[model samples]
Target: MQLAIGISACLLGQKVRYDGGHKASEFCLSQLQPYVRYQAVCPENAIGLGTPRPAIRLMKKTQGDIHLVQVSDASIDHTDAMHQFTEQALPAMSALAGFIVCAKSPSCGMERVRLFNEQGHQLGKAGVGLFTRQLMQRYPWLPVEEDGRLHDPMLWENFITRIFACHDYQQLCREGFSVGALVAFHSRYKFLVMAHSPSAYRELGRLVAQAKLFEPEELKQRYLQDLMHALKQACSRKTHANVLQHLQGFFKKHLSSKERQELSSLIDRFRLGHLPLMAPITLLLHHLSRFEHPYLAAQTYLQPFPEALGLRG
Candidate 1:
């Protein structure tokens, strides 16, 4: 299925910035564009700003209020215009599985955009871009990423994984929401949830167990909210190691002593940061090829994204 992703038009190489220059990302253009579809937008341009026009900045007011106004003169406010654009843009963006925003932009930055006081003193990168803040508030469960953050391997993989999962979940909703479908979906994500947050795994299991108590709509909302929140927690080396060890348990009866020793050693090395995560996972996949562990083989954590993406490697 094609996953529709919202992207800052400038990052997608669209000439929509105030300077008439785009902040294009080669990785995004070359690697990611092929896997997912795009819905590029420029909030500034959406607010009737012309190319090569005046630059804007987020100005801070008393009581920590922030406003989007002209960088040269804060008297010229565009906050309401941007808000109106976001409201009008929501319907078109309702189908998007994810969003990739330009970093540190006054209109689209996801976080830490520069803030200025009324007197022109710098506050810090503590403000979220107005349009992006509204977008996220409107769709709290959508996976959002910055073009700059996509440079990091882990963050890139996590972002892609989330969007893919969100797409799948939304598709399931379109088909129908049955308790059985929810169970199957949760089953696939078992190890993934564990690797990210074990507590979430337990909580999700309990919620699924009692799924019948809530209405279908209520259950979908509650379960998806918790699931997305769990996925938001970055999976650390320790947590990854724990999940790897859990996978190792499935092959205990199938693997020889030598194979077990080799696997354990690899896991130890990965846990110690001596190797990338691809090492132990590759070995596990190799073992699964010969071994018949259906449960372990079905876990999405092992292959979250397309192998051609080579995110783990």
Candidate 2:
């Protein structure tokens, strides 16, 4: 899958700032690099703010109005400039399935950024960065996260998984649906959903079963929406565990006793915290692939892009 991901330029180790420093994210650049197509951007710099320029801050008026203002001179309203930069860049970012922003910058912060009163006293928590807010508003389904959150293995995996799933959904969006294809797609994401919500698997199966009643276009739209929503809602760990347990159902007819035992052991190890969920999932997918069944072979879930993100353009 050719997935586009927007990244904070500094995080990608680009020295495109006034301070001549980069806040490079090693994991994102090294680990995720192979899997996604990155479009690194720096809104402030891209908006013609020269390096060494006065820093910008979110400021609040006495009337409770908040605005991103210049720290060096309170008189400057840089909102229009930032907005224009975002608008001009929209076309470039349209293909992105997700984004990773620096945690707290006036131009890219995703949440909990500081806002100050006119007197320069810290007031309270404020909204997201100018560019990040606009991006989310435009593409509500795009998976977005802060660089700091990537340190947590679960969240990191979730973020990456969502992006790739979105890519899968994009393919599904174009080609429409098939019962077998849907099942195979679900199979690939079994462990991920299991980590979030178990009951969702049953619900997804129901959707696929009922799909025959609708036209291909209608079914495609409806099922894709449900599929993506289920994934979004199942992002919690408890929800995922539930989905994982239910996935074992698909293997009932396909696996030998020893294979099932090995997979079961892996699942138990994962549940006991002795192994990563991916360990068990790897085994399940391996066996799933061994099936000579055509439906199983057509499953995009099994090979939803390898470790390479393909972003180096």
Candidate 3:
């Protein structure tokens, strides 16, 4: 329920830039702020680069090159500066269960920052924000998304759910793995796994049932790893189809024939990409309360956080 969300200063409507402009995200403020504690950080401003500073771009290199240098004062390496800030921020970042980064920043971009040649012509989206890369490398399981993707309900829901899961996993690690924790965790993710890989879910269940025989320490590590792995495998479209179909079966008795047929047709359209997973998933989640049991409903699954963080502008 409590989460630490690292967000871009601009997204929070802060005038931290050199130019004194803000790119505020109303949704983040109204929705997410109420759910968790937010820690805002702008790397450009943090590194003593004031707002309205000369716009920095990533200089492209010819093939077989992997050099990352500052756009201005190429000779004055800023790599160390980035490293220094990451080191300083590590302690502050350790407790955060998730992050929301600004997409496409040279120092903060998570993925697909624009690469340019010497002349600043468009090359390709190849580079990651220096700090973003470091954060991922340090905490592989932490949920991190770009602010843009949060606009989509599916992506937004996925990110928050994943953050909670990661936070819960860390707690499990602290308290030690037990049959109760394992059962509860499995229940939360059961339908989700069914969508991705039913076989893997079964295998994981078997593992959890047998966890009693192994050393407690070993069980903790093995279970957490397997649990995360199951979630990873469960993220595909094919898996989602399986889960939705199963959920549909549960609702047949409750829904009228016409409604059943309409829902089935929508599911089919979703399979063909005529509709996004959100449309059906949204309806299912709303009705999930009817099922009572958390595991049997289709609302319990989560998507990987990285896919949710987006910056289109």
Candidate 4:
């Protein structure tokens, strides 16, 4: 099945913004739209706020007390209504692999949204959007990103990697849960976990080792939470180089001195930032195809997402 993703309606070119204009993302529209199914949401619109409605802002009433209110008139609060809508909407969104939310929106921003004091003074950017906060609190494992942050290549790649991984796990769950299947899933993602965090890699290994002790539901929740948390760490060039070298060990017996030197050179060049990640990865994949190592072939690290996305470059 194609992966399902939750996205802000405006990002999908829907004119659902407060001003009756859309914050359409070309990347989401032209590039990512083809690969996955999108579930578009407009929280403000869902809560009976009509098009061209009065804009809203998050106002801090006291410590741990914030309200979503009209920007021009603070007394018109929508926090309760937004909460009610989110409580109703999120249950249906449990199947989504990821979410893309508009940045700096009072209703949908993921982080650093503008906050206001009672006197109308700027309280700096420290608030999370009302709807998004609940969405995260309910489903901490789901991959969520702000639309603007996707412009950064590293963040973009990381988010894509996460959603694909999430979808893989979701598929595994749908196939039915088993300890052996869980182990196989972890085996496929072993190198990927190591690339992001060596410590998490080891921890996850122990978790899977003791999987039989926990109930199946508990095991699924714990494994997914830990796995998603580990993936959130960005893999550095240094880390990628290390993983590449580890992968090189698999082909050591199959390669000639010349072939080994060539692969090592490509990895070294990539580590020094002279080449994109795809350079060494391509070489590794080529070697894997020729050598036919079942372990290496099973790994998702080799091709995390659809190659057509060209995200590695």
Backbone-clash count (model 4): 0
lDDT of 4 at 71: 87
**Where in model 4 is the C-alpha error above 4 Å?**
none
lDDT values for all models: 0.90, 0.72, 0.70, 0.94
What is the per-residue lDDT of model 3 for residues 45-77, given as tens digits with 9 covering 90 to 100? 787777677566566556634334556655544
Number of colliding residue pairs in each model: 0, 20, 9, 0
RMSD over all Cα atoms, model 4? 1.0
For model 3, give the 10-residue run with minimal summed lDDT: 304-313
Error of 1 at 132 (Å): 0.3
Error of 4 at 51 (Å): 0.3
lDDT of 2 by residue, 1-313 (tens): 5678899999999886557777899877888887678889998888788876777888878887667798878778788898998988877775677899998887788998888888888866766788888888876667889999888766675676677778877776557567667666666665544444557666776777776677777766566556555556535434434544555667879888987788777777776677765676677667766765554445433343464542211
Q: Each candidate's TM vs. the true structure?
A: 0.95, 0.78, 0.70, 0.98
| Rank by lDDT (best first) | 4, 1, 2, 3
Tell me how candidate 2 scores on lDDT. 0.72
Pairs with steric clashes in candidate 1: none
What is the C-alpha lDDT profile of model 1 across 97-147, one tens digit per residue? 899999999988999899999999898988899989999998888899899
Q: Which stretches of candidate 3 lie over 4 Å from their true place?
A: 59-70, 116-123, 152-154, 171-176, 196-203, 206-238, 244-313
1-313 per-residue lDDT for model 4 (tens digits): 8999999999988999988999999879987989899999999999999998998999999675999999889999998999999999999999999999999998899999999999899999999999899999999999999999999988999999999999999999999989999999999999999999989999999999999999999999999999999999999889889899999999999999999999999999999999999999999999988989999999888899989998887
Among all candidates shown, the one with the greatest TM-score: 4
